[model samples]
Target: MDLNLRKAILSNVSGHNTEQLEATIVDAVQNGEEKMLPGLGVLFEMIWKEASEDEKQEMLETLEQSLQHNQVQ
Candidate 1:
């Protein structure tokens, strides 16, 4: 059984408007389910592919801050 998670995730959300996509992300994050991580990674992969170098740097910085904050706890 070959399950292509990336393609499946994209297919499920293809053609979604910005609001719809935002809602999906919000729901998944707020739910905090481990099963949602892969889907979020796939979505982030798509964003990474489309992001400019500056955008990528911003994302890295934001992630770094988040991790550092957690480390302080």
Candidate 2:
């Protein structure tokens, strides 16, 4: 059987509005489950694909700052 996990994830959240999407992301992060990672990755991929160059640069800067500030276990 051929499985497309990204497509499946996209399909699941296809019709969600901003509020619903924010809730999904909040729940996933709050729950901190490994299984939720792929869904988050899919969401990030969607954002990355849609972002403009300046937006992408800002996101990268934010990510870099976050990584620099956060402590790893």
In model 1, the runs with Cα more than 4 Å from the true position are: none
Candidate 2 lDDT by residue in tens digits, 13-36: 999999999999999999999999
Q: lDDT for model 2, please.
A: 0.97
Encode model 1's per-residue lDDT on 1-73: one tens digit a residue: 9999889999999999999999999999999999999989999999999999999999999999999889964
What 10-residue stretch in candidate 2 is worst by lDDT?
64-73
Range of the 10 consecutive residues with the lowest summed lDDT in candidate 1: 64-73
Clashes of each: 0, 0
In model 2, the runs with Cα more than 4 Å from the true position are none
lDDT (0-100) at residue 50 of candidate 1?
100
- Deviation in angstroms for 25 in model 1? 0.3
Q: Which candidate is the best by lDDT?
A: 2
Score every model by TM-score: 0.93, 0.94
Error of 1 at 19 (Å): 0.6
